[model samples]
Structures are given as structure tokens and as C-alpha cells.
Target chain A: MSGLKNGILVAALLALGACTGNPWDDAAGVGGPGAAGLGAGSALDPQSPAYFQQEVGDRVLFAVDQSSLSEAAKSTLVGQARWLTANPDFIVTIQGHADEQGTREYNLALGARRANAAREFLISQGIAGSRLKVVSFGKERPVEICSNEACYAQNRRAVTVLAGGLTG
Target chain B: MRTYLASLAIGAALVGAAFMATAQTAAAQDGPLRIEITDGVIEPLPYAVPDFVAETPAAAELAREMSRVIAADLSGTGLFREIPASAQIAKINNFDAPISFPDWKAINAQALITGGLSVNGNRVTVRFRGYDVFAERELGTGLQFSGTTDGWRRMAHKVADVIYSRITGESGYFDSRVVFVSESGPKNDRRKRLAIMDYDGANVQYLTNSAAIVLAPRFSPTGDRVLYTSYESGVPQIYVLDVGSVQRRVLSTDEGIMSFAPRFAPDGRTVVYSQAQGGNTDIYTLNIETGQRQRLTSAPSIETAPSFSPDGRQIVFESDRSGAPQLYVMAATGGEARRISFGSGRYGTPVWSPRGDLVAFTKQNKGRFHIGVMRLDGSEERLLTASFLDEGPTWSPNGRVIMFTRETRGENGRALLYSVDISGRNLKPVRTPDGASDPAWSPLQK
Candidate 1:
């Protein structure tokens, strides 16, 4: 146990300790769904107390309403897959986001599909399926705000956030 | 929130009785004599509403303001016009005074509207009457409306609606309610809750607490109930609320799915909504009365924004079945889904017209969003608005107009409610107390 009295714990150490308990608890957050979810846990876990502290790698962007990864996006993702492969004890989350042109729910689904597409591509690139996760903010998180195509292009992106550090 | 409404800035003064002071001075300001009955099409009744016949000097201004508000309320709708209080050759003395119908007819006035208001302890009662000079019979019986000292303006609009309905044979659109999401805080962390207000955007009443984010609030066919989606339980879920008592209950919480975008079926016993599960969403129907749910769609493609036809036989929804979001229709029983949207980059949030004639939806073509309506078969697509974001079109009870939320794109985002007639003649913003979205116009309350 790393309960060394006066040592300051890095976020990776904290996340790794939290992850040792359960993955669902890591995802579900405090008062979120337990392992037996749906009804056993509360309907909403607004704040994830057990928030992930995965190291962020390279980012990926897509075209408007298009989740297809560009060459640059693919190359950056290659770098991400390499980093994830080196950190064998870590699990990663892929968050997909879209610009604000589409409806809220549709954007959410688009984000989900985009995240999944990214995760699948990573799995194809040698990352273990269980080591990867995905979430979609839909149009909720717009990195750009202009009405033109440029802003939307920047917003339609898949971000890889890593968590749970490997230990000896 | 109604209690909070008790504190908003009260608008215009209640109308006072018109008193016949002098015919000579009043006759000098006659506006115009425009009255006609051509081809069996009855035009708005022309009236010479001389400032109310004020009996006391203090009552003179209240009388004038009341008459002006009345004329503005009527003629502002492009319906009626003032024949000038001066046009009345024979002055009608007072509201309850004996009057000869011939005197008003002599000036070619088709209708006469007069009101008298009495101020009591912190309250006012407006007594208004409408008469059809052409038919020589009272159009709407004399109506008495009581309001707080500040609610005189609403009482006045209510009076105008009574006259409009009594003469036009159509239910009054005024006096109805609009329920929407009130936004506060920064754009990134918006806190939204359900709010109800008068159709004119007066007397905003917050219905739900801001403990959670609420979205897509749809009014029940009856004004007393509201159907909306809440994020209270982490997952977005639908809830039905009693507008009067503010009592609420979760409508559908099936397993791990998220239910949102709810609208009542015509029967009011059931609601159609989109349930998201496993990264996919499909339409589902919930019998709120019996706690039963029937899945209407089984496609892995995203199927959402389901709206039932007026008769509940067919459904119009937005689906990504065509590789992009497009409009589609199928039997309410879920069979033979036909693609209805052809000219579009992406379309979502389709609401069937209450008249059973058309479906309104949000379309994103060439990266710009537009609010458009098409026939049930997706034949005639007419885009009503083009903007950064214009979604969630809710129709007036008459089906003549559709109102939707419009959010202007910028670092500082602002969402407002706007309405456009199906004819596209009247495109106006519905005034709201704060930033508003997901406005559902309630059916005209009886």
C-alpha cells in the first residue's frame, strides 16, 4: 500500500489506486451506477468524483458532420496508439465532440459514433480493446465558435484522455 | 415560479369605461371608414371608439389609454381598424347607456367594443362588451376579468382575444401559455429549467427547480400538464408535471436507456420519445397512464425526433438511415419506413403539423441550419429560417404558425424563441424574460 504518510500522490497514482477497486466505479463516479447498473445506482452521476487522470496525447479533427479521420488525424492517432501501447497498465478514454449545427441528441450520437470509430481504429492499431474507452459530448463542447466551416471543422474532433498508470 | 411572476414589471394600465363627453370635438379626428363584405369574406369590423365617455376628470386618461390599447390590440393583428371616435355621428353616452344600433351603423361601423374598469383594493375588474353593429346583436357577451393591480395589461389582451374569437369563430390565441427552458450561467455551464409564461411573454413562471438541466419542454394538449426531459438522474429522462400544482413524476425510466425529446400523443394518454442506449437512439412510445412502453424502431441507425400525425396513424421522424440525417415517415405501428427528405445535408427534430398537413424540422444543408416544413410525404420543403442554429419547431394550436428556438452563434451565445406563420408572412421573436429555448406552445386553454 502506498499509504506513505507524507508523500504527495500524483494523479496517476490516485487513479491507479482508484482503478484497482473497479472499472465501473471509475466510470460511474461517486453515487453513479455500481457494477449492477441501470436501477441499482442513481439515475445520474453528475460529477465523476473518480474522474480519470489519463495523460493526453495528440488530438484528431474531422470535417463538418463527417467523422472520417483525415491523414493528419490518422498520423497523430498513430502516435497516440504508440504512447498507449507503451503504457500497458493504463486505460484510455476517447471523447468525441461536434460543432453546433446539428440537433443536440444527434450531435451526441454523432460524437459517440466518432469516439467509437476512433477507438476501433486504435484497436486495429494494436491497442487492447479493454484498454480503451469512449464518450461523446455531442455539440456540448465546441472548441471553436465561428459559424463558418473552419470552426466546425475544428470542433468535430476525437480527443484521447488517458488514465490508470502501470505499476511494478 | 408563479410567485416569482408576481414580481415582474406590470405592463400597461387596464382600460377604463368610455364616456360620451362631446360629439363635436370627437368627430374631428375620424381616422378612416374602411368596412366591406365582399365575396362573403367578412373583413375586420371598423369601429369608431371615441375615447371612453369618461364621467370624472381623473378617469379621462385611463379611458383613453384603455381605448388605444384596445385599438392597438385589435388593429395591430391586421384585423381591425379604428373608425375614429370622431366618426360616431351620434355619440354613445356610456358602456351601459342605452344606445341605438342605427347610430353606430350610420357611420358604417361593423363592430363596437367598449370596456369599463373599476379599481378596488389592489385589484381591478375590467368589464368589456363586444357588439356586432351589422347584425345588431352582441358578439361576445359582456365579460368581467379580475386581475392584480399590475395584471391590467394581460386582462386587456384577454379582452381583445374574447372579441377576436366571438367575431372570427376561431379560438383565441392569446391567453395561452408557452413553456421553455430558462438559461443562466455561462454558455459552457448552462443551467436550464422549465419555465412557463403568457403567450405574449408576460408573467414568466419557472416550473422546475434548476437543480438539473432540463430540455425540450412540450406542453400537454391541455395547458395544465407539461412534458419535458430532465437530467436530474444523470441520464436524461422524461417527466410529466402538473402546471398548476407543480407535481411531477418520471414518465419512462427503462433500464439503462436515456429518454428525452418527449411529446404527447393526441390522445394525451401516451408520449413518443427518443431513447438512447448503446450509442444508438430509437423512438419509443410510453403509455403514461398504464406505464407500458412499446419500441417503435429497431434500427441501429439513429432514429429520433419522432412526431405523430394528428390522427396518430403515421409518424414523421429524423433518421440517419440514408448515411446522413434525413426525414422519414412510417406507420405509427412501425412498418415500411419511407424516406421523406431528399434535398438536405442533414435533417433532425421533425415535428408533424398539428393540422395533419405538413412536418416541420431542422435542416443542415451546406453547413447552415434552417427550419423548414414539408408535406407529410416530404414533397414541398419550404425553409422558414436560415441561421446558425434553428431547431425545435413547435406549432400554434391552429397549425397556422410554428415557433422554434434560435441560437445566435458567437463566443457569447444567446438563444431566443421565434415564430413564423406557415405562410411565412409574420416572422417575429417571442419576447422572453431571459434566454429561452425549446419552447412548446400549449394548445389554447379553455
Candidate 2:
């Protein structure tokens, strides 16, 4: 039942993306003569952080009380790894979070495990370990505030946040 | 925070000529005024505290306020009920006057408390006595206390503590404080600051600003220091703060590793906390003075929230070694642990009671969270509360009550502090200016 609902939600999001003129679909005709011009830092630009977040997906969700990565999560991480490699000047921090179903201390440890899993996968995909740092917010920070499983699924995620100027 | 009042001056000699003999022997004979707290249903012993007599003109308001505070401290315990002064047939106009036993019996007041207050410049003095109306004798020795006028509330609590101990035969928890994380803002972007307040949620003082996230503030054995986890360095690290000076320093736990759930040992010099490294979390003990470290548990699964028994002989903690979180007991020095929670649920955050009789914990079973207590052997588990989310149980000084954090469900959910007796009775919310969580009760003040 949830899978069917998720499919509908994804289809609706794609329809909205088409209306917004998603740049990934227009990238093939970009830079050609008389083609629509796109700014370098705009969300439509493939090399921008905005594009990485919207098109490539910066976050991956997890199951309840489990830190192991799923197949869909791996696919998202692959895109994240490629973006990180292409933009070598940016350093990323993997923020791991959990739902409000567990104790505070245990959730913290679980978040750490999730962030470390993402960090390890990125390293395996040819990204330097030095450019990747991990921090667990536990259940303290949630993207969705509802108490149902849909919100919890969105809250239990690891996001790759990029910052300019890599010190290392 | 209020100028740090001087230590209370306890009068040495007993007062009142009616103190013919020690009330301890009389109480031992099973008087009609006794209350057995372990009973299934308590009647709430009826007690009365008339407005204390003001010996000086300037002490009239202070006397009345102090009397109210004393009555509140006693009635808040859920074991006693305070009869209103309007219900009293005999008014105490003089502190030293002989009590009218028949008038008190007429109102069905089993216990009576009388007090006198005097003010001289910045110095204030209070004297109080407890009585058993049925026996027509004093319950305990009359006592006197002297302190600055700013400490009037604490003086009242001291008097209430004495009366409570004399009647219940157990130490009172009124003269203690609680350290917690004060929260504000919405659920998604909540801000947390370290805060300390009196046991009854009075005199709240913020120890740290909300610039950084802080969690699990714990008081030292002497209530002079607090240890908590902060993300000031962008990673969770334990920091110890002196309560009086408000000065803080982070304990050294290696860089780039997450350390949290810090708790002070009974000796006050050592700390036990969880450290996460390489995605594996384990428990470790660190000595504050020597910078020495000891690995208490090297389990592959999560092991955290370690608490020491009052005797400092054993430690109770939570671990997921059995594929799910459960309570475990091991020596304070470290070794093989014995699993103590056999029930059908996941358990974490086990805190040993100060009296060394039971361990309080948070259990999540069938989608509901509960605050529960169990015997040392894991037998006779009794849940005190059930809510959408309830965690982090901290014991009162006397081990008769447990305070925990309860968060409501939905987008507008917020955390609040709630306390309950060990018998699963008297559940009520503690008032805080903002949202609060992670409460740690301090030992009784010296």
C-alpha cells in the first residue's frame, strides 16, 4: 500500500518538475546556438550546488532503527559521489538524523552509524576521505514534523551538505 | 544567582517546653499519625500550616509567604494534603502557645505545624515545630534556622524537610535542585540551553546560552558541578561546568569522536560516558583530574547510558547486544554483564535509584513509550507512565519519585518535564518557562 502511494507521490513530483522546466532534461540542447541561456549558479545549471540538491539528490532515507544502506540509497549516493568528485573545491558534511521513536542517547548512536555508513560508501566511490566529515544530530533535527510513518521516513535520512573552501 | 546566600545557621538547642521526650520512640510505637507509602491507595494524611506568626512588623508578608511555601512542599509529595487555614478552628497567634488538641481534632487535622519569623536588617530567623494532634505531643524537636532575607524560600524548605522526615521516616527531597536542557523554538529548529532550577521548579537559572545544542545535564555528587554534551565544536563532546562560577571546560575525549551521555561517579572525580568511533559506540570512564581513560565495554553493539549504584560497587546500563536494547548490570570497574530486562520490549537509559533498591528506565513497546521501574533482578516491573514519547528518568534524592521528559505528538509537539511516584501515582507536569528535557536531580544541599 505504501509503495503504491510512494509511486504516485514520485509521479506527481516529476510532473511538477516538468512544469518548472527541469534543467537536466534541457541540458542536451544547452550552449547550442539560440538555445535557452542558463546562469552558472542557477538551479538549472548542472555544475551548481542547487542542481546537485534538486537533480542529483543530496539525501537518502533509511528504515526504522537500521543504518544499513538500501538499494535506492546506494543509487542516490552514487550521484552524490560523482558530484563531489566533479566539484573538488567543496567539502561536504554528512548530517545523519533519526525519527522520534527511540531514546535520546540510543538515537544519537544510531545516527552516528548512519552517517558513517554514508561516509564509507562515498570513500569507496573514489571521493577523498578527508573531504567528507560526519555529524549526528540524533532525533533533534527533523525535516518533517508529523508523527506518522511518512514523516518519520523523511526525517530518518543522511544529507550531504556542501561548504566552499576545503581546508584540508 | 540571587547573590549566593550564606550557609544557613542551624540553632543547636531544642526549643519549646512541650518537647518532654524524643518523638522517635513515640513514632516507633506505631502512632495513629503514621503513613505507609507502599500501600496501594493512600488517604493523604491531613495536615495544617496556619500562617506563621510575625514576631516583627516587617516580617508579616515574609511569614505568610514562607508558610505557604512550606505547605506546598509537603502537599506536593502526594502523601499529604494541606487543610486550608479557613478550615482550622484554632488559630496560632503566638508561636509558643500551647496547642488546643480538641480544636485540631475537630477539624480532623492529624498533623499540625507552627512557626515564627523575625527580621533584623538583612538577617532573618525562623523557628518551627511539628505536632501530632491525636497523641497531643510534638512529633519532633523544635528547630530554628537563620539566614539572609533572600534565602527565605530555602529556609521554608528546610523546615518542610524536617517535618517530612519526622513524619514519613524517609529523607526529604525538597532541599535539592535539578539540572536540565531548556528548549525553545519550533520542533524542527529547536534551541537548547543548559539550565538549573530548584526541585519544585523555582529559581531557574540558565547556565549556557542557546547558541549551541546541549543535552543531558547531570549534577555532581555534591551539586557543585554539571556535565553535559555540547556541539560547540561541531561534534558532540562532554563539557563540565561549575554551578557557582558558571565556568566550563570540555573534557578531553580525543578529537573527531562523538562523546555524550556523561554521568559523574559517586566520587565526583570520575565520569562514565559513551564514545562513538568508526560507527561503533561503546562505554568508557574518564578521570577528570588525571586525564586517564578506561574502556568499560567494547561490545560490537551499542552500549551507553551507564549509571552507578549509590554504593559505587556496580553499574547499570543499556545495551543492544541481544539484538535489541535492554538493561544490563555489571561491576563499576568493568567486566561481563548480566542482562536484567527479560520483558518483551526495548529498554534504554537505566538509572539506579539513590536508595539502591530499584532501577528506573525508558521502555518502548508496541509503538508506545513508557517510564518504568524494576527491581535489581529485573522482577516486578511497574510502568509509571505511557505517552507518545517519554524518556530519560531521573530519581529524586529520596528515590520515591522519578522525573522524565514527555513529548507530545504532531507538528506542534514539544517536550515537557513530568514526575511520578514509584507506585505509579501522582503523575503531574513540572512548570518551566519554555520546553524542557533531560532532567537530572541533585543530591540534597549541604
Candidate 3:
């Protein structure tokens, strides 16, 4: 039964890979073992935003003061793009956040860059730009509220939140 | 010890000369023994502020309250030590009563302040005189302030500013306001709104509701308008607010760009802020009246947190163009920039001091954040406060002190406001109704 679930998830992700124009681009990590594990949960409940938030993973982390997406971030965003493509009825706002390491205004700008990066990537993956809006909370809101590196890593992220509407 | 001059028996003229010589030496030896300290750190001068004499029944409570505030203002500076009422050796019953210098001297009080108050219906008057008790003379001219009863605290602050300026040789920062972000809610989803209060964190008035997130509230040169970034429209945009009527309008709404970290030029007509476009952020200035816009920095690297010098001829800002964030200065019109900070750490939030002598900034070095200052030439850098998370520094109006936000680390962490002197003394937490950050001190009240 597990093998069948893994097969189905791999097939779906490989279909997503076919949407891309370049085969040499292994940056998305499509059809990998990670995809099988992510398929274990209720992959996509078309009716539930909670399923999209919890199962699809709402956020992606970035390196210190960086808005560029890492390979791991790209892989997670691939999953997000797939889910967002499936749930076209939902409009999402991507909130970019930063660690407490930089100044307030700089962090705000960095957050904006991060959110834009995420928004642009989602759009590239066939999600409509109008469906994805972006806002930057800067260092104002931190998921992990510690000053040390462990927490800073988690705090530097861009999160996609569903505004919850069937029609925009 | 007395000096005796050797005199000839040439007459009374010679005798008089000898007497005058002896008297001159005696006067030199016994003169007022006053300490004229021009500068440098010394013990806080001890002073006494007896309750102000109330000339009418309506003034009784306000008189005491005014004196209390005056004492708090002086003592709060950490430059003057208030001799408590318990330590008072004598009290002045009349506003014009002679100061008992001997009593003050006996108690080691270096200065004394005597005040009188009168209230009739809606009007109030405060008369105050500062005395250099040891020198046995009134220090500076006695002054009186008149205002409505509702504005009694402002009158008290003005009186204190007068006294503080007379003694400290620098202008006072007590009669100023601070605009900051008030925060609440859980860590992951905190809410922030723009709020303004006195320099001492009193008279808090919320300028914007918390329905949307706001960051970096800055005061206009005249303190009549506030510039802040709000996410009310689901995107970060700058909004200018009239502080008096609470009316607000979007300052800039360039298509598909995020603008934040705004500051008013010294002239108050133009504003400088950071706007992010196509994943690139830079600084821009806008004329409020004519709606003219100018791009200050076009670097691919991020450039934000721009502050104008008091003279408005130049601007100091933080940029990551040097690979790591560092302080830089450029002409107000924007051109080639000269790097100002060569330190080993990341430097940001460079706010030029109103005095034009130093720029206060936040530095992150070796896993610690600090609030620090440096001269305009990028020399004499001094870190004032060090902690896990200390950022967003704003200069006091007189440029004697700085207030910034410091956040603690944990799952339940929160941000608090703090102020410290430029001399790196008297670090105190500013009292707020809730968590606060991004403090911008307003110019001295008119």
C-alpha cells in the first residue's frame, strides 16, 4: 500500500516536472525520494485551506540577509507551487519576514525582496500573479523568537497565507 | 595664611599700597571656592527643589505636581542628584524669600530651585528661579510661564528646560515627543501601530489603529506630521499622518513597489525613503507639495535607512554594496558615495545626530547586536549598549541621548524601548503601555 502511494505521488510530481522547459535543471528536486515522503499525508483536499497550509508547508526559509532561494527552498517551493496550482480558487498573501540580525528598515526591504522572490517563482510555475500578493512584516514578526542562530534561521522566511475566497 | 608686604616709611600712600597688597592676597585666598567644571564626567550636582509655594487654593495640588515633575526632569538626566524632601535643611515659604545659603551648604546642596504657582479659573502661571547656593547668587534670570490649566505639565517641562539649559550649557531635550511602534499579540503574529508620546514616555496617543502592520514611524521637522509604512493595503506603503487631527494620506503609491523606512529632510518639505522594485531596493526622495520624485541610489545592492544631516546638505545611510552592510554618506542630490564605516561588523540604521557631530547606528558583531555612535568622518565609534537584539536608534532632539528597541530571545520574546546618553551612561528602559519599537524623537516643542 505504501509503495502504491509513493508511486502515485512520484507520478504527480514527475508530471509537474514535465511542465518545466529544461531537463538539466535539477534545482527543483522533482520525483525525488522527498516527494514520496511528502505524499504520505492527505496530499490535497481541494476544499480545505488548512490542508494546504499544514500539508503543503506554508513557509520557506532563506539564508542570512539573502532573498535568493536555496535548493532546499526551491524544492519546498516546488511543492507549494503544485499545491497552489491545484487550488486555483484560493488567493494567498505571501508575508516575508526576517531575523532579528539586521536593522529594522533594511530588514523590511530584505523581507520585501524575499516575498517578491517567492511570488515571482510561484508565478513562473503557472500560478497567476493576481492570485499571489506579497507583504513584508520585516523583523516585526518572528516565528522563532530567539536572538541566537538556531532561532534566526527559522525566523528568516517567507510564508504564504490563504485569504480564503473561492473567487477573487 | 595672610601676606604682609614689606613697606617703606615713605607716607600714608606707601602704607595704603601695602594694605592693598595684603588685601588682594587675602581676597585671592578666601574667594568663593566654587568649582567651575567645564566638561568631563563628574559626580552629579546635588540640588534641592522644595514644593512650589501655592499662591491660591486652586494651585495647591498643581503646584506640588509641577515641582515634582521639575525634580524628575532634572534628576532623570543623571547629571543632577535631587536631595529628597527628607534631606531638606530649610524650605522657602515665599517665592522671594532669601535663600538660606548656609543651610544648603551645611547639607552639601550645590544648587537650589524655588518656584511659585498661581491658578485662576483656566489660566495657570509658574515662576521659577534657580540658585547656585554655594556661590550665593541666583544662577541665570528667573523666568515665568503662563498657560491653560490643561497644559500645566508642558509649562512645567518648559520651566525645567530653562533650568536644565542654564546649568548644563546644552539645550534641553525634555520638552520633546517620540513616535514609536506599539506592539502586542504573540510572537509569530505580532501587531504594530504608530503611537506618539512625550520624550519621557508620557501622554501616549495612538496615531494609527492596529488593523494593519506599521513599521518605522518618523517625525517631520516641525513635529506636525508623521511618516510611517503601513500594510493596510496588503502591501507596504508609506503614509503621512497629520498628528493633530489624525488624518492621513498615502505619501507614495508607485505601482507595484514597497516603500518603507522614510524620513523627513531638515526642511520638512521633502522626504527620503526606501522603495523596493523588481527585487531591488534603493533610496528615493519626494517633494510633498509638488509631487516631484528623485531617485537617490540606483545600486543593485540594497540601500535604505537614509537620514539627512541637520544642515540637509548631506545624507547618511546604510548599504550592503560593500558586500556587507556599512555606513555611507552622499550628497543630498545623490551621487558617488564614500564609505564611512570600516569596522569588522555589519553597521546599519545610521541616524545623524541633530548636533551634526555623531551618527548613531546599530552594529552586529560576533553574534551580538549593539547600539553605537561614530563621528561623521567615520571615526571615534563608540558602542553605547550591547545585548542580543538592539537595533533601530533615534536621536534625542538635543542629540544628547538615543532611544532604540531591544528584544530578548526566547519563544515568548518581546521588544522594549530603551534610551542612553551619548556619554554611555544612564541606560534606562522607557516605560510603555505595551511592547514598543522604532522610536523617532521629535524636534523640541515650540
Candidate 4:
């Protein structure tokens, strides 16, 4: 489960946490978006690094810095609701995010707003409110890597991720 | 009076047109090139750092060589003019005795750097004292170093850093190291590896091999390690590199997620970065020793590029949460966030200055990119440079100048390094062998 040197790791952590003992700080410097959808060749499969069963067409997207549902976003939520309604027992977490063009904390707040925006839209579409959860990445995951306006325009979005499943 | 005023107006218009014409020529093919601090007093300060004169035979030469390098580094920035040893009016007679301020002032040196070195086998101990010329008292007492003799250059830089801090009331950058992606070969197939260099760009050493694509390598305050994003496994992953032994380890392994733009927590233990999951991205932190992952943010918007304030209490990052990419600040522990950028165009690479008063960043307006700085509240925004693209600003330890990447068209499409003072004066090339980007200044060596 681990690779690379052990001493530097210990030293760096000691230096970082020497002042304040914040356990949650472990998640500080992670940025980048890889190919997201579950793939047959993914290491997360039971035969892979870590994998779980995923239903078809399971992800959602958002507009630039907006968590509010547009007509198009509402339509996307309706499609998501149909999937949830058909399954009747799926649990999901909505992760909100901002792009690389704004500040970090505001993006976190904005990411929260966007995730709520999508969650509200899905609930209105008839998905049980409790069956859906929300989280915000705030410009952490970027499908596109460049820093230009074109790339940032696409990175500001909210997504719906399937978590636990309820057996009938 | 009317006729005279017309001639004065005409003369001023001609000068302005000439400058505009040059800018237009640069614009016709590429983008913007302008310097805001057009006029200033640029009289470089003169000081002397004669051979440190180690007390022992083996340490003697090193002391001399190190002092010379320190002198050169200080003068290289064009902020200082070093007095040659040939012009020395008096020798450093004693390391423990009080400095003869009158002797130094007689030579008209506004400042002075005098030190002694004691070589103890493999280890070298250096001690230097700084003087305040007019005050006639010691500005610095014990500026010292105890390190491997082999790293004599770094030791020298450390000495220069101490001298800089004592005189300027600001931290010295000379003692710090620069973490950047070193490049070679053609632009299309250029091979780049994460490398570490002394602040003055000496003793360039590669930290990561070319087997991966490394972007934005940032240094920890201690200067012993680096945090950078690499494409070694064909996806962006945050990795920590140890400077002493040249080893790296992956920090993030969220399946189907790409993690990039890694910056160390001011404390140097954890890191704050962005992770892309599915099609969404958010900022997260990783503890180096313990594989503890805490999700500080949970928004579905794209959040990347997180820089921590010097105190480690807050973080500044770029986001499009406001409908456009702008700078924002939040508590480092994660909480309510506020907007700080209100200029124009897109802004990225917000680097908090070591002085903690300003954040240096890249601002793009009207198709032209600029390197500018603003207060923590996003006020008093000053544009330092304008060019085809001026991004990734790194502050000098003193926060006096900003070093960033500049790219021109044609043969120079590749990025070259340029430097400018915070006042916007003294725009000049940093003299890299080829070109450079992501310039991180080191803390003054104490």
C-alpha cells in the first residue's frame, strides 16, 4: 500500500505538525483531476487497488461557479432521479467544487453552494432527500489541466457520486 | 504661454508614442510588455565582505571562497555594489572584538559584512558580524553556520542572507533554495526534471528524473525537501522529494482522481492541494508521516492552486466560484471563505509574500497577462510587469522584487526568467543558461 522513503516522510510531517496538531491537515496539498468514471481496467476493481460496483450513467456536472440549477441542470437532475427512482435505494454524495481562477476558501464555500444547488435540484426531481448527501471539492478536481479561461470554464462544476447501496 | 504649453504637450506626446510603438511591435506578434515604475533612484548600496579568514589552515580557503561567493550573489541582484578586497582600508583583526565602525565609514560604505570561519574536519562553523555604519554599533551579533563543508556555497548564501536581514529589517533570501523544473532540448520534446538551485542560481542539482513531467515544484521553509506534481504514472500525482537523498513518494492515490499543484503547509508537515474526482475538483490536505486524509472542502466546483499564508492560519487559492477565476482566502483549518481579487481577466498562482503583507499573483486583462501584487484584502493592486504571459511569481526573501516566468514569441516561445522590484523598477533577465519558470526564493540563511 506504500512506496518511497520513510525517513523524509517522518521528517516532513514532524516539521509540519510541530506547531499545531491538526489531524485533518493531512489532506492539504492535493490538486489534479484524473479520468473519473469507473473503468473496467481500473485498479479499484475487486481485482484492482480498490473498487465498488457502479450503475450506468452515474455522474453529474455543474455550471461555472454556480450551484443553482439552470433548466439544463434541472434536466440533468431529472435524469439522475430517474436512475435513483428506478433503483429505489441508492445513496449518493454531491461533491461541490470551483475552478483554479478564484481564491481557495471562497471556492470551498462556492463549492458547497453548488453541491447544495444540485442536491436541491435532485430532490425536487423526486429522489428521496435523505438518500442523497453532499460534499465540496472546491476547485480541487479538474478534468482539464490548463490554466487558461477555456480550461477553468469547464473545471467549475458539481458532481453526483454513488456511495453505499441498500439491498431490498 | 499658450504656444509654450503646446510645445511641452507635443514633447510629452512624442515620448509616450515612442513607448507605445515599442509595445505595439511586441503586441503585433504576441501580447503585452510594459513596466509601471518608470522612474526611480537606482543607486546600489556598497559594502565589503572580505575573505572570512578562517582561523585554521584547512578552513582558511573555504572561508575566503565562501565570502567571495556571498559578495557576488548580493551584487548580482544589482541591489548592491561590493567593494573589492584590493580596496580594503583595514583588515578584520578580531572576531570577538567590537567592530571599528569608523574605519568602515571612512571608506564610505553604508554597510559591512565581516565574519570568521573555523573548519573542524568535515564540519565547518562560520560566524559573521554585521555593522551599522552611521550608528557605530553592531547591527548583527552572531550570524553563524554549522554544516557540511562540501555545501560551502549554500553556507555562503546563508551568510549573505543573515547580512541582508540585519540591515534591511527583512528576512534574507540568499540562504533559501529555489525549487523549479529544469528544462533541456527542443520546445516540443523538451525534457524537464524538478531541480533545486541556490537562490542566486548556483549549484543547480536535479531532484527528479526526466521519466516524469513535473510542474510547480515548491520548497518547504526548511529547504530540505520539495513538493511537486508529477505525471510519472501517466496522471498528475502530488509527490514529496527529499533534497538530501533524492527520493520521492506519492502523497495522493484517490483512484480515478488527478492531484496537482502541491504546496506545503507553512509548518512543512502537511500539504494543501487540489484533487480531481470524476469531473469535479476540490482542495485537500495530506499528512506526510501519517496517511491521514481530511477533506477540508466538499464543494463540487473546481478548486485548485492553494497557497498557505506564512502563519499557516489561512490559505489563498484561485477559483472560478465567483463566475470567473479570481483570488480568495480561507482559514487554513477550513471555514468561511471571502473574495480578495477584483481586478480583471483571470488570475492564477497567488504566492503570499514572506513579509506577509502582500500576495504576488498573475492577472490577465485584455488578452494580456500581468504579474501584480495586492494586499490581503485585495486592495492597492500594482501591476509589476506586462507581457505575452507573465505568470508564477516568486518573492525575494525581502519581498522587494518578484521573479516570474516570461514568454515571448518566435525563437523565444519558450519561457525565460525575468525579475522586477515590487516598485516596478529594475526589470531585467535573471541570466539562466536556457530559460526557467516557477522561481521560489529561499529564506535568508541565519
Q: How high is the lDDT of residue B178 in model 3?
A: 93
Better of 1 and 3 by lDDT: 3
* Tens digit per residue, CA lDDT, model 3, A11-34: 543443322121211112222323
Residue pairs with colliding backbones in model 2 are none
Sorted into a CAPRI-style docking class, model 3 comes out as acceptable
Docking class of 2: acceptable
The ten-residue window of minimal lDDT in model 2 chain A covers: A26-35
**Model 3 stretches astray by more than 4 angstroms:** A1-39, A46-56, A82-92, A123-132, A162-168, B1-38
lDDT of 1: 0.68
Per-residue lDDT of candidate 4, residues B101-151 (tens digit): 777778777667788888888998888876645545454356577898888
Predicted candidate 4 versus true structure: per-residue lDDT over A97-116, tens digit per residue = 67654433345556666777
User: After aligning candidate 4 to the native by TM-score, how far in Å is the CA of A11 from where it should be?
Assistant: 48
> What tens-digit string does per-residue lDDT give for candidate 1 at B1-446?
00011211110011112211221122244211122211134355576555654544444556567667667666644456678866677765577875578988898877788777666565666777776665565543577877775766667667777666544434456656789998875454466889998776878999987777788888777777888877676446789999999999888766334677788888888898887665577888888878888888989888888888989888888889878889889888787799988984788888887778888988888757888888877787888888878888988776766889899887578889998766554577888878889888888766
Q: Which stretches of candidate 2 lie over 4 Å from their true place?
A: A1-43, A166-168, B1-21, B24-32
For candidate 4, give the DockQ: 0.03
Give lDDT for model 3: 0.80
Worst 10 residues of 1 chain B by lDDT: B1-10
Identify the candidate with maximal lDDT.
2
As a whole number from 0 to 100, the lDDT of residue B245 in candidate 2 is 100
Candidate 3 at residue B66, lDDT? 92
- Docking quality level of the chain pair in candidate 1: incorrect
TM-scores of the candidates are 0.72, 0.89, 0.85, 0.62
lDDT of 4 at B151: 81
Q: Per-residue CA lDDT of candidate 3, range B1-446, in tens?
A: 11122321221132244333433443343332222223456477788889999988899999999999889888888888888989887888899878879999888887788999999999999999887676676655677899999888888888888777655545778889999999987665577889999887889999988877888889999999999988777678899999999999998877556888889999999999999876678999999999999999999888999999999999999999988889999999999998999988999999999989899999999988999999999999999999988998998888888999998877577899999888888899999999998899999999
- Looking at chain B only, the TM-scores across the models are 0.77, 0.94, 0.92, 0.79
Candidate 2 chain B lDDT trough over 10 residues, lowest sum: B1-10
